[model samples]
Target: MTLKKLASRAITEIGAVLDSALPHQVEVMAAPILNAKRIALYGVGREGLMMKSLAMRLFHLGLDAHVVGDMTTPPLGTGDMLIVSAGPGEFSTVSGLIDVAKTAGAATMCVTATPDGTVPQSVTHVVHLEAQTMANDQEGATSVLPMGSLFEAVQFLFFEMVILHLRDQMGLSANAMRANHTNLE
Candidate 1:
């Protein structure tokens, strides 16, 4: 296939995934960010990278957001939130962290393609990102994106839309968010 065709295919696939995503799920994901005193985010591999992107955006929006396991990350406790992604929804490490957060009195939110999985079962809220992940990306999957790329890509876009809604909900202007960007960068 030509580069143009590949680009078109990717765009079309991503659009289809976004179209089917439930608005209520996104709203559930956003609630902790808006209400928590601090937000801690985690995911593994490409999914983790997407969560990092979201942490950055949430910080720029003036929320106290941290990537889990970061050197500067403080302890999570009451009034804090932990947002995690487990697209296939059974990562042992994520499940462990969720347990820790819950034990420490923090609320948990999970983003997953498999809502019925063990990790989501323990979280306080869930945002179902119904897309193909590496586990289910055999011959019959609809996305042209490889492995869990579709889930990760949708996560990046979904987080941006959540930030947009959050900005409006919090009465923050674009200028205010920009001002929060690191001057050192």
Candidate 2:
């Protein structure tokens, strides 16, 4: 019963958090998606998977979207955009990537739980969400849920909302995205 209550509270609280911030996040993501010259994405670990999913939807919307570290991650020399998800916003490798992208003059956006972290200063856009979920297997200072599971789940949920917004704005058909889904699957 103790375990059940903890799980229930975590889910409800995480849901409440997303319900509050999602509208603003989608609104922030839209302008860059609509106007970007190039849209490259980066995220670490499970967050990377979430960002990859968002990038795929952007591709379905006909934007020039690609994941970072892929063969197709072309130079974002100017006016191009990089969207990264960093929950704590202080992951070492992600910080380094932010540094490189900033030096190259790429516009960057970070969706993070910590607004005060290093990436915000280096990037062009910021979307801050207050999540009580930890990342990885450790209990982060900010996570109420163990090991960031709630954080990972919320990230996935947020991307789906972003896809919904993109579909409406870009006029993408379900058939079109379906066509792009890997045939190997």
Candidate 3:
């Protein structure tokens, strides 16, 4: 196949997979945070940055949300939600965080590319996206991109979509969210 054709095909496949996964993500993400006292999120590398964005949106939705290690994040208490993004589902740091989540008696959810992998069984919920390509560039002869790029892009896309869904589900106003934006920016 020509290089252009190969790249185009890769794009099509990734878009379709991410689109199909969106509904499942929206459906699952909504219910868990609805009644929680707060949502403490975790992820590592590129995935973790995406979680930060999601947490920011959650804060806009009038929920208490924070990145796991941030000073404002605080410890997860009973009736809280711990959300983590584990693209491969076996990251060492992710496993460690899940242990903390469980110990605190909080509900844990992992968004991963491997649902049946090690992290799935230990968590309360899983959003699985088995990606064929991701953003990590590497020196190889492969036509498609390297690991986790598509996954990371789609993770951000879907998380932004969740912001819209949360507004509808939880009755948040865009004006209110904007008001919450940092004035020091």
Best by lDDT: 1
Better of 1 and 2 by TM-score: 1
Residues 84-158 of candidate 2: C-alpha lDDT, one tens digit per residue: 888876788888887888788888899887777777656788877677535444533544566666777787777
Which model is ahead, 2 or 3, in terms of TM-score?
A: 3
lDDT tens per residue, model 1, 85-151: 9999899999999999999999999999999999998899989988899989988887788999989
How does each model score on TM-score?
0.96, 0.85, 0.86
For residue 119, what is the lDDT in candidate 1?
Answer: 96
TM-score: which candidate is best? 1
Each prediction's Cα RMSD? 1.0, 2.7, 3.2
Error of 3 at 27 (Å): 0.5
Clashing pairs in 3: 134-148, 134-149, 134-150, 135-148, 135-149
lDDT of each: 0.91, 0.78, 0.80
**lDDT value for model 1:** 0.91
The alpha-carbon lDDT assigned to residue 22 of candidate 1 equals: 49
The number of residue pairs in model 1 that clash at the backbone is 0
